[model samples]
Target: MEPEPTSQRTSANNSTYSAAGVDTAAGDLAVELMKSSVKATHGPEVMGGVGGFAGLFDASFLLSYRRPLLATSTDGVGTKVAIAQAIDKHDTIGQDLVGMVVDDIAVVGAKPLFMTDYIACGKVVPNRIADIVRGVADACSATGTALVGGETAEHPGLLGVDDYDVAGAATGVVEADGVLGAELVRDGDVVLALGSSGLHSNGYSLVRHILSVAGLGYGDRSEDLGATWGEALLEPTRLYTSPLLRLIEKLPGGVHSLSHVTGGGIAANLARVLPVGNWSEIDRSTWSPSPVFRVLNDIAGTSLESSEGTWNLGIGFLAVVSPDVASEAISTLAEDGIPAWQVGTVGTGSRPSGDFESGAKGVDGGAVRLIGTYRDGAK
Candidate 1:
């Protein structure tokens, strides 16, 4: 079918955005390069080709579900890209971008349908651009998310040479009646810890600063690392959708909450959906962190307390479900090649692991005092 006009079609008001450092020419070139990448990932659900004024998808399929809900998440790869640039690695950041997002939707039990990216570079280098695109496409393909569109930007004035930033937006669908999200999270649910592949893209700024002070090479190789520093740091973020969907489908309808351990780590992100008056007790010893966490901790001499607060602490995505189904859910993840383990449980207990003993209702005006991760370290 012929495509429709884009939603944000730009007009020659060139005066307004020109100051924002957006260039029509560079943006145009970037779009050209990304067209194929986007189209390749599209399927019948994609509403139009890449150059359309707006990205679109045929949610017509939603009519079949008794309850239909559309979920969206937008995120950026933080300073982790800086490390990738420093070490001349561009691939994994792509996975990092997807991980930062779709994982959030996964928390709500929404299956990611399509994704678009925004890349800003001071100057376009074929090799560099290709590397990142390769990363983006690879991760998109892995997650079953169609890379339908993206924005490539060139701004020599604003973006310094060899410096670029990456961000992306993902849209997903679920039956309205079947939207599994923080709402499903209850006081008695279980939290499953999915293994992280070596600091899967967060807390890198601190990591770089620590290395800078210690005169350590981010790419330095040691037996402790199993690989070069760059290789370890650049390890792509894991895609949990397939395994997660499988788990949710395999398990009965009791699976309650899902938290994508991202920028906030376990403590912050999990609390987003946790029911008020409820507490999440995450057992730290449930799974072993990959070796990279210790290396970064040692390099930065990060206090264990701070590490728990800032880093993913080796657990990337936490799946919360009814206590009885938690183990089976974790196993289902393993069946699909994802490393998962039971990390914690939900309760009406005390701080960190339980609900706020007393507090006002929350954003939804619900009585809730959310406490995730009480005082135990996931050692």
Candidate 2:
């Protein structure tokens, strides 16, 4: 029974999982390459390490709280990954995932405890997958979250070989009374706008459309941006969990409600965290949107206001705090290097005749409107 010559092997006998498009070996190699970085995010609280069926975290610390409310958030990097893949940059995108997921948890004043990532790719390019996971691991460490486990799935036919998408889920714990939400917001509460690093993880579809219409490639350098278009667009999202957590701990009663300006843009997202029967007029003049936005709007030949429903513009996270502690909160965020400013004040008995963005994202909450022209007068 001599083995058939290697070149003479029939298609039937040559068929394998690899031939079918999945590469188990590359997946294993990816895990191996990403192991150290993943482990670096683990502390004593993380049990069973990587490659586990499920991640384990020690929850005994919650015993110290009279009542613990667990907060969980899950999100993907959105079409922002399209630019990363176009530019072949995998590292920084993971931070965007963390910023989207874990930062959402921080919106409720929760301290992220652990995170798990899921990467779906058309092919398991070991180094590329490893780079993606390593990015996730690094961000998890930065946010004090344990990267206990993750899955790298190969969806060969479903996606293009060079295409991949990353999403993650994070869990955080907060004291029952420490939960920040609309109920905690009050009349005369000052809304502090925290500056975003750039376009976080939303509105990329529009960005891509604008760039496509302008016939610009991600690799093309933008004289106005001072970097490649992709580089400017892929600027890692600012992680606010650590800083917001510090603000909460440092100024116990200074912080009340919080909002992560994502998906729905500023006013809509902020409206979600405001108490019913209350409204706030976010002053656009308080801060100018970063250049990345201005550049894109200029390319698209539209007013910045046109994308207000789709982009964060400039603000990333909004904090509604008691007026007395508003200045202290702004100064506190500044200590953490996050520029903060008063965008609006919560008010009651407001009866505005004009349209307002309220009850967004099925929250049925308060109303918000962007008043005043942008500082740069772009509106």
Candidate 3:
């Protein structure tokens, strides 16, 4: 009687998890698609590859250092992902993620060892995921970092199928004595502005606002930009890790501090690594903002003062170096194809009053301001 008549449970509706928005099979397929690119970033030191609960990496090399301090950074592409989504371009956003995460490690003079990424999307579109992971792997390889593992989560109802956000975490190591920043920065240190590739994964909220106010879409082409808005805005964030790592190694003690200019613009970021007592006046005339920035400013009719706090303007990274070695650093960076110039100088002064004196995340630091005016197409 318990056995009763044999019956198989079946639903009139062919329901599946994919029908509910999430597709585990699609996620697995994405993993298969991205495996090669992820592996390409791994070296002999990477222990276990992808598809693991946790990534394994060999830290035995750190044993050689007298005192190795690990540096870790986590960052996202921010609202810049909106631009990528609007443009339907997924490849470059991963590079922006890597740039934001790994480059911060470089600021402390650490060599990036490995990176992991997180992708949250409403649906797992295998091709799009592959494009993003491929970009991440390419960037990790370029920066000499291993892409050991990552996770892609599909949240069907929480976000739109076409909407996604990318973030990454990177770990690096530096000898304790080799960490670069405020401790090494001093008065008379020259501030060099490393030119940006474009608006490197920051200030896009303002960018979108201006574009919308001007009644422009991502596909709109501007004569000034020489490309569609999407193409211009999607410029991948420049990876400063390699060039900067080389600069630090080639000229030890020459680079005092490095500021990765992202969210808070030049003054704010540069102030982060500056000592409290010293101030810096960055000459805005040193380099012109990229056309994308200039166009947005023109369209929005925003003042440089208003934009300074939100955008990188022109400079992407600032290097504080001893004046004696400034020229060498500039020349070496130039040889590496990174255009840099002395944009300001550290001076003796008390931290200024008001918001200007506050560094990134409201940490107290020296006064920093962008003086003068942006040059017209200085390049």
Candidate 3 local lDDT, 41-107, one digit each (tens): 8898998757876788889988899999999999999998888888788998889999999999999
Per-model lDDT: 0.69, 0.86, 0.85
Q: Mind giving the per-residue lDDT tens digits that candidate 2 earns over 280-351?
A: 888888888998888899988999899999999988999999899888888888999899999989988855
What residue pairs are clashing in model 3?
Answer: none
**Winning candidate number (TM-score):** 2
Which portions of model 1 miss their true places by more than 4 Å? 1-36, 47-50, 349-379
Residue 99, model 1: lDDT of: 83
TM-scores for every predicted model = 0.83, 0.94, 0.93
Compared to the true structure, candidate 1 yields what TM-score?
Answer: 0.83
Q: After superposition, how far is residue 260 of candidate 1 from its true place, in Å?
A: 0.8
Candidate 1 lDDT by residue in tens digits, 264-288: 5666666666666556556655555
lDDT of 1 at 198: 63
